[model samples]
Target chain A: MDRVGTVGIVGVGLIGATIGLALRQRAVAGQVVGVDIDAQAIAAAREIGALDAGGSDLDALRPADLVVVAVPPDDVVSTAVQAAAVMKRGSILTDVASTKAEIVRALDERLAGRVRYIGGHPMAGSEGRGARMADPALLSGRPFLLTPTDRTDPAAVSMMTEVAERLGMLPVLLSPDDHDDLVAQVSHLPYLMAVAVVGAATDRAIGIGGPAFAGLGRIARGPVELWVQICRSNRAAIRRSLGQFRRELDRLERALEGEEPLEILLQRSRRRAPVDGVPLDKPPR
Target chain B: MDRVGTVGIVGVGLIGATIGLALRQRAVAGQVVGVDIDAQAIAAAREIGALDAGGSDLDALRPADLVVVAVPPDDVVSTAVQAAAVMKRGSILTDVASTKAEIVRALDERLAGRVRYIGGHPMAGSEGRGARMADPALLSGRPFLLTPTDRTDPAAVSMMTEVAERLGMLPVLLSPDDHDDLVAQVSHLPYLMAVAVVGAATDRAIGIGGPAFAGLGRIARGPVELWVQICRSNRAAIRRSLGQFRRELDRLERALEGEEPLEILLQRSRRRAPVDGVPLDKPPR
Candidate 1:
């Protein structure tokens, strides 16, 4: 946003609205235009001053110098394509999708030369959803993963990094492959495993859900529709992550069944202890 | 403890010291004797007002109306056997061990007709250890599982229930099998999976441990020695629980592989939402 005059935001949901709010609060965007399929989300985004103007149409993204596609993974590629077409010829498009590899591939195939694209993932979110849950400082001091393929414009990536920094985020560069692989194990699989843990509970145990079980299973309570799409989009990576979990669990199980000591596994896990700055230690509700 | 004059707490660590402090604060026992292999723990117990008197000798448990075995699960039966033999014949002996089936079985064989034994477990704790982390209200308004077979004295069970109530607990009656099954799935399996989740994390993901992964993996960071004993002692139940987890996770993975909707699983897991009583949400330092 250093030299960019206008910014366009598509799909003004939680992440979308938060980015809009943070950018507006920092005056990073001279004019912000918000677009959403949900009229209420667009209206709410405008009500919170997250945008200077809002519309319930894709055409609203036309006037911006830069466009940010803040949609769910399933919608990210399509939204990126739409925003890329609507934006000015030289304008860049980026996405805030959890899974970057698929979106980056799609962008490379569709809009490689016509328009530049960078994949972004702000490694922060809550179990909560909607524009109502938006906050201006939600991205403050958080890591924003900038995943760029060989096809991505270098200048666009640098400008996006500057914008990320201006909005109070630490922009860390990663390949689409590395980003997806890391998040699958750290984020996606953790969410699915939470579901498995809760689902594995007996009826009586469900009725008597203790702290450990409840806390571990909290992320399973997030939006099912969105996660279903995420799971579908990143099926291979998530499955691989789950497989890793099973293998480790199987090894521990073997040790346990054979009455062998659990010292090694226990020691390995101790590294994830109550360390400060670890979001996992203080997960959002 | 209505008629009981003195209470003996063997292994004066977090749980033991918390029980001692709660009993003393409620005036449930005229005197609370703390016994531990660790001399510093006994000294800390006395210093923190969790103990009315403290000693490191096994004979310290002999002069009490109720001798409470508060050792690790692996040592629960052995400690109870020692405490049962040392205490007065008519005096009741209860344990604060997590696994009830094994300890209850041990009591039926060893103390039957010779000394009354009630299997007790307070279903509340933090990750922190030692008397320094003890809280008088640790068990307040939390579930306390009581496993008593037909051979257990009715009066001893009733008195133990009263004592649990005095310490601000809701005494829930569960058979050894029910207790073990419930805790295996609800408590033990969750902890083991936390270890597995952390263990499965790649070096990069571990370095980027987000809130979801860290929060889900929090229990993995707890003391290893105690968990090794808990894992070994409850091997059968925990293994079965891990199997249940594996099956559920496999089903989810299959669903993902098949590109099937996860609405039902996600909805089911939402039941484990944020609850105030859960200590996993607020783990000790």
Candidate 2:
């Protein structure tokens, strides 16, 4: 896919700006052009040297060899469909949205013949949002999961893998359904658990809190508008993961309440330790 | 209380080394001597200038106007009892153990009139431990909770506050029981939740794991032996907080499974926002 020349980046938000920065850092030969509904965001991308040029016009992106939709989750499908309608034939398109299954289905239904569309989710971000917090190094050493459907062309998948490798990310390939289930367990479920724990701490009867509470609760402060769309779109998987977490929580509660020996609780927690892969180390400063 | 000069610190581990460093920075009109069970730790503290003098002997702590016990949680009370027996009659004593009620109770029951013991828990630490990581700035702007029982000398509490203020930590007065409950909600409960989340993720059926899982799981990686002691000693409060968390998890489970709208989940999580306080913009790099 060396013929993949120009790269069109839709939405100059954190993810878009970061991808642009990463491309520039690696000196990827393709011309990186940005498209954003926000004129100010386009300007900010230019100021950060993340784009050769960017504007509010979608037509400016039509000639690109590769198109990346980095809009919010709710906008991913619609944006891809709109961009697909105007794209040059054989040009590939992909998204960096959190959830994949729905977006993959939407792209399949709307943009099947217009361009090869792949779903991508980079498991990296700062608590802060927008262009200011965008770092080229943000995706370094992070997993960049790609969900390619049966309809996706093999060359398109390889082309996206090339970009992910250029960004210093480890690319993992999976089917759309597999990707959704995996993230439901890792990303989405943990977020819900964080929200629940935060809710419990804020209960009036408890009046319980400390720095640790704050640290654990910090995950709940994400933009609600964005998360709402994600949860609604991936309801089935999210619900399943939530059920799994609840069962574990119940097990812990029963252990705490029962006069079970402390060794049992310790053993239970220890047995579950291998899930994290790496040895539990102190939180990074 | 100006007469309370020359503070001696025993067990120059993370807490002890940090206290010595903070005292040195504040120049609190007192000499700071450090003692540790590990000769290497004592030598390390001396090399870093975290102590005016260092040795492995408890006798080296005898000349101090006040003594600070900063050992692991398990050794807190035993060390305090020993310090009380050896420290001069008018000398004050304090500790930086996470759990306050137990240590305060131990001091009250074991060393009633021998020394003025006030318990303090500074809510600050880096993942880095020992003298090499010691920084006077560690406690700045962090909360330093003081749990002084009625039997403890008011003068000792004031002295502890003076030190906290000098180090730039906000001195918060709390009853031992209240402090324990607060920390359980804040610290212990979060640690337990992290462990549980990590454990749940480890289940073989799910097979989904990555750095995000590892990042969230890092809280469980703290010295397990330390946590074992902490969980065992603070069992009552930790168990209660965990129960409260479990109830919230049950509610979330029901909501996710039942016909609750997506907005309801968002609203529930938003209401719990205060549990996190202000977002930690970014940790110190």
Candidate 3:
């Protein structure tokens, strides 16, 4: 909770680099250190000034008041555990992985009381991956969710919230299970939908696609390795969302095949309409 | 063939009024005429200067050198037939309906060489509908598809192409069936996907949706009556695309559940990379 003296960032990927840039702009820390197992990535982080110093050593994070694990979803658990083991006692530790329930469960099972660990997931991400696409502006005005259970340190959560605010993100609190279910319905489901649409298409179909088609399938091009882990880790919730979507799609298909009442089918959208109490059936005059 | 002595637009809804505005800007016609079954729609179109003259009768389009029908899918065939009966022979006629084959068949069966009729579809529409949302710039820089079979008039196709270009649109040639199949995969299927996703979602889930969720579900808000008609008219093609998508989703789901090699699944995206063929595994250095 002390205005963090030093911030150590492990895995200088897009989220990591963007976070590093934000920390630097706010001068919230006396020094920033970036660590990566990929030696060349450490060099890239240093060249871009995403760190005051960079190296392939975990020991460098020992002095940092806050350590952020921004590694891939597959590596998040082990890397977060490693950061906890090396960093100073009472120093806050957090991660920016998308899927939360399992990671928070894994961390809570391993690192609680040893190191202050609060899980975070930022909602902003670009279609383009890696540090080259990272920007300080990327995190601007975005939402970040913090999953803290009864076991989490209260002061660590407050410090993490302050850091998220300085990065220009609004912080919301949720339980890890709730976070996964909510994101599965919104974020994870959309990516799977895009992948399904694009995978079923041919080049001829893509050639004719404009803004609507492109926007709808944009995230299907995300790195396969990353998405595989994300989808697998959160399989149950994703499957539930997909099951609901299939039933909804069947309803629409049946309606297309028969003289179904469209007004009844569109009843939900009407309730969410931004318009005044005007009936959609009555076109503007 | 002719420089459109008088351009007539039927329907006076969003597409119809937008066409009137474009024709007026180019001065391609001696005068632009607007006609609609709804009397108030004509008043709205004229009030916006989208029409030089407007009326509620089909006969008001009698003096036109060309007529553009932009009504709903259910009304397109009958409206085109009515316009053909009233407008003079050799006066080119086209309908801007999303689905083409049925309407083109309806025109060929009824008006063959009696009046030149071509099918056109502009790849531009807003979530907002009607004359109040109409803009002269709406059709600018959009793609317009002209679907023609062997029986279609060459001069009518040329005139429609010229009109599309004047409105700053690119005109592409497509067979009616080909157009339907392509749009089914890229456009119609995406819309249905959005509807299914949004329709199945709870308000809590939508509250946390980011860009991917919002953009993917954006078009689900299109008017219910129009979308119901669109889905029904093109049911066969849409069903085919949806079937393909479901199969594709099953494959990805199995991959997430099993120890499948993600690289093989992601091969197409790597080939289509905007990056320098750097393996996504190798984080940027």
Top candidate, metric lDDT: 1
Order the candidate numbers by lDDT, best to worst: 1, 3, 2
Cα shift from native, residue A78, model 1 (Å): 2.2
Question: RMSD in angstroms, all models?
Answer: 4.8, 4.4, 5.3
Per-residue CA lDDT of model 3 for A192-254, tens digit only, reads 787778677766676566556767545666767787788878988888888888888788778
Q: Tell how far residue A162 is off in model 1, in angstroms.
A: 2.7
Q: Score every model by TM-score.
A: 0.89, 0.90, 0.87
CA-based DockQ, model 1: 0.43
Task: Kindly list the per-residue Cα lDDT of model 1 for residues B71-186, writing each as its tens digit.
Answer: 88888888888777788887888888878887799788898765788898898888678999999766878888889898889988898899988889888888988888888887
Q: Encode model 3's per-residue lDDT on B50-74: one tens digit a residue.
A: 9999888899888988999999989
As for candidate 3, its interface RMSD to one decimal place is 5.8
Arranged by DockQ, best first: 1, 2, 3
**Candidate 1 clashing pairs?**
A211-B278, A279-B211, A280-B210, A280-B211, A280-B214, A280-B215
- The reply for model 3, stretches above 4 Å from the true place, is A26-31, A37-53, A259-263, A267-285, B24-30, B37-50, B55-57, B135-141, B259-263, B266-285
Between prediction 1 and prediction 3, the one with superior lDDT is 1
How far off is residue B206 in model 1, in Å? 1.6
Task: List where candidate 2 sits over 4 angstroms from the true fold.
Answer: A1-3, A202-211, A254-285, B1-4, B202-214, B254-285
Q: State in Å the error of residue A74, model 1.
A: 1.5
